[model samples]
Target: MTARKEEAGPSGLASALVASGALRSDWLTTFNAVPRGMFVPDRIWPGIADGTRQNPVVDRVRDPVAWLRAVYSDIPLTTQWDDGSHSGDGLGQTPSSSSSQPHMVFSMLADLDVTDGNRVLEIGTGTGWNAGLLAHRLGGGNVVSIEFDPDVAEQAGENQRNAGLCPLVIVGDGRLGYAEGAPYDRVIATCSVGEVPRAWVAQTLAGGLIVAPWGTLYGGEAIVRLTVDGGTASGRFTRSSAFMRLRQQRPDLPRHDVYLKGREWPADGIGSTTTLSPAEVGGWLEQFAIGLQMPGAFWTVERYDDGTYTLWTYSTDTLSWASADHEPGADAFHVVQSGPRRLWDETEAAYAWWDGQGRPGFDRFGLTVDSDGERAWLDSPDHPVRCTDP
Candidate 1:
């Protein structure tokens, strides 16, 4: 192991996570027992180390200090991008794969409530840290993990072997949920899924639990914990997390210029009757609501030096919208929004409804799976439409 990784092992990481209020005594024991450095590489992106714009490339094998900080810190250490075709070797636009930060992994595992005898299936093995953790908590034979990329799966398998974890790692689509070993007690996905796959619910035994990162086509990401009831499973948002987009459902990497061309405004014009910014509105709904309403609205938030902020969202299907914190009396941003869906508006409405319910959110929400389709709320299971809107 690199000296930097050596420094972060056990004590340093334990202290950092504990102080951050993200570590519990039992969980900390698990974190300490497993060597995180074994699952990560000896080099990583040192984001804005000087508290400026420069994100220097640091080598753990070479720079012990840099390695220790990167390894121990709660921030996610990105591993691959563009489905491993493009390396994080040098910083760029896309982030394809990664070893999820320690806190996120611990949080999800804690939500799973797995035990020694539980059989687990993990989607998107990535660096295999989670699978290893599962294997450690459960047993090597009790875990099965799948990855889409052949190279990534192979690498993850090696990482698991190196870490002395014996999870049955496979290279294939995770949507199928490793049916060869059916009736898993727990299923967890590290990658973000656009929808909960039917197979996941089908394969999980009655009363099993599935904890995954789910969202809509647009971009609201949240961690969902669904408990399988008979055949269906449902739960609420345990926390908020950002993960690499699922391989099959990833959006096209659109150029900024293409979206900006010939932008049109709604006849109602910029000074419309809207109270909240698009992002704030987007966050109001579950990611599913945003995705169903706005098929491809991509958003970017930028902060300016003059203590001003700008939020921009572009869509190919719906009317694009932008709002700035300090407009300086600029004409209201015109929105030529025209569609039956009215994506953003619908998202806002859903948020309003959810908030109206005292923000019942996901914790109160439950899942019910049956012969037809899976549903989010138990009371709504009898309704014609079962799936949650995104």
Candidate 2:
């Protein structure tokens, strides 16, 4: 009851999505039929439009109007936190499951490009809303969804049933796509992955599409739509996205202490000054382009009370670490490099290459996955993206 009442509903959201072109005309009917409200839970944390931050809980029993408005809004609703371990309506350490933003849902569905009678397999049946949407599009028998968490799968099934849809909801690892429904005409993943699972490619039919959110170790992610070839699947990133990382693929990165190894500020580290402010390279696209070249690298920030901060970059293996001091209203920034690899230098070089290529967006970058592994390319498969080695 504490939640401020707002004037919102499905019609307003639908109109906004339609104007934005994310709610395409072809899928308009199913979009309306499969109302998102049915799939949302009693209590939820709604997220910001373009950021990962979440708002206070809006419980259906306590604030039905607020809950209804949140369910119909274009933003995501976090249904589970810390893998369902956290409690008490406050934000959790990490968001585990969610009903994805309506805009993103329909956008990815558009990328799926499904036709009548096309068999589809979806990874991460979070709330079954997506599965319900697909089931409504094709028949219930044509859609299969996999969830790793048994509890989540059970709830998703209940939600689907309540919505009058019966997509096969299986409790299993999403990384290992359900083999029982092999040779699917389309495979879509609601969760993001560091690497595309080979099983997804193997299970998909030739010429079928696999649309999923893909990210790198460094940072930044985008939706990639791949066409399954005889053995491999290759395609370009369609749009920027920030979905919850697949539980299996979640990284256990090395600690900063491991990299420091008892060294204090600038200890045994070479000091250098650079014209490139750390702020210049913090944009989403910049991170994506740099992550393509600087594999096994990640960053953290240390802020000072006076509005200045240090951007700390580290190599996954603790072989290298770099720090850049960024101060407001400053033309130059100080940088220090230690260990074997120059992480900051590699990042700068990657950014320069992206700039050299006219700063191509997500659409210009492509991915090719085969038995060997996945490789990123600038425009086409032939022009493979080069890695900045130590």
Candidate 3:
């Protein structure tokens, strides 16, 4: 390993996470064994930024430093696009694959309770970072990772080979899990699932643990940990994470014209009155509430010569949201208000509720999943059920 990567080893970051109570002492070897830099290419954004994702450009034969930093950093790197509509040959807006952030992967693994000799099956073979960690910890033969995108799968295979950590890397829809490797000690998904695939639960050995990111109707994402009981599995939200929306479940981009047409004023006591940017507020909703409330506003952030800012949210349902500079005020933006759902009201109310809760996140939300589906409660097992969605 290079000197720079050596400096970022599990010793420092692992110590920090342990001090913060995010990780334990025993898993340090997994961190050391898998040099994250080897999996990532050089010159990429550490996290998603701007109006889209942060791109990590790789030139295997050139710019080794850039590659090393991205590889070693605990951040995820986007790898694929449009679920094959775009090619992994280059980078673009659509991110179909990624090497998930190290801290997040570590956190998820800690939650999985992976022990020595554990037979593990991982979903989403993105950049193969998680698979590397698993293989390092539990011998190559004990690890199996599946990816849906064929090109991505091939690339990940190459990365795994380069890292000299080999496992059963397969290109297949993860929704089915790896039936041939059923009864796994642990099944973890690096990708997000709109719903807990029933096949995963059935395939897990009774008492085995399944960790996955579950998408909710409320707009937020939660890491759910389920332990198979009888034929059912039950667990709760361990944390909050955002993954590129699933291929089959990606929301249909609403009609721009239809949304614009509904931009109007108050009708039947329902109108847009808030001076908050709906985009910021809505994204916040995913973090604050269980995602039951979705911000119905949108905006284009503009900076003025006077150092002022302008933000707006327009919808075809006649409900428009706008905000300006200063402590959350907007300029002479537009508002067309009319909708059965009262988009602004729902958004504001959810925001208010989030504030009331003091902005709890994965630290507060607990999950319990079984054959019946999944439920989101608070931190304590006895806490009030917050979300029960499929």
Candidate 4:
């Protein structure tokens, strides 16, 4: 056991979460029951409190104190990298699984709003700490968690057993919520998805709630708490988030080379300048607003050593591309557009729409999903957010 003086423990984390208003008094007992340390693997890459970047691995065997400190901190812990293919302790290209930030976990559970006998179905079991917490709160029989990765599910089961909680952990596609546990009172997803699976809504009770991290193809994400109503579900975003993309819903974007077609910079592309700096649209809320309007669009940035960079926007179909050049202390920035769609203009228009709406935050944006598919709205469902002529 790690000495209390060496590092902050559960008490420290609980106090921080409580101070943040994420760890509610109702869930405090369950939080203590399902200690995150037991569910965490021997090796992990600790993430910073506010951002997504992960630090190097901290093996409990190698350094117990550091591991304990990381375990208790209100931050994510990457448990699997590249779907468990990447070997050794070094960082991997993509983080596939993790023990989510304690703040996020409890906040989402609060969003879930479960009652005493409510049946719950959780997508993406991951480390099973969330499932364990739920199981501890509402008995093991009332909770069912599904994970796509078999090994991850096995480990999660082991962790649950060790923690003295056994929520049914299914090894299957999370996008297809387990039908065996149909008509659940609550459904929650640990991972983020570009689109909410219809199965999740279908399996949930009519008046039940589904809390999931939803993002757009362009950029930006937030926790959405949707209330299931007949064959439709709609709700506003609760808070900003940056969860890993759900594996199946992950978009495979076309490469920059495909858009360039082996041509040099600004080859046969229209050139223009705009007063709007590239930095203005890079914020989380800005991206979410822009993403809602700009469908089939995504962005990447190429930075230079002289405090400048080119913001590249690409269409999924590889038919449209845009670039905005950003330099320090400049009122106007150079812009280029190629192919049919003027991606930069669309983005600017979207940003303008958001700015015109008095720059409302995530709370104002809501999503409606039905047989007609999903539609994002600014204030009400009638006024759907859509692309404007740029």
* Local accuracy of candidate 3 as per-residue lDDT tens digits, 229-290: 76677776777787775565565534434544553422233333455444455463343462
Model 2 RMSD in angstroms = 3.0
lDDT of 4 by residue, 1-390 (tens): 965552478988988899999999999999888889999999988984222354778999999989999999988888888888977788777789999999999999999999999999999999999999999999999999999999999999999999999899999999999998888999999999999999999998999999999998888999999999989999989999889888998788788899889989888789999999999999988999999998888999999999999999998889889999999899999999998889999989999999999999999989999999998897899898986432
lDDT of 4: 0.91
Output the lDDT of residue 319, model 3: 40
Comparing 2 with 3 on TM-score, the higher-scoring candidate is 2
Specify the poorest-scoring 10-residue window by lDDT in model 2.
Answer: 47-56
- The backbone clash count of each candidate, in order, is 15, 0, 36, 0
lDDT of 1 by residue, 273-346 (tens): 35544444535345544443444565555678875555545554444444334343444433223333344455
Worst 10 residues of 3 by lDDT: 263-272
Model 4 residue 257 lDDT score: 93
- What are the Cα lDDT values of the candidates? 0.68, 0.91, 0.65, 0.91
Q: How does each model score on TM-score?
A: 0.79, 0.96, 0.77, 0.96
Total clashes for model 3: 36
Off by over 4 Å in 4: 1-7, 48-54, 388-390
Q: After superposition, how far is residue 365 of candidate 3 from its true place, in Å?
A: 1.4
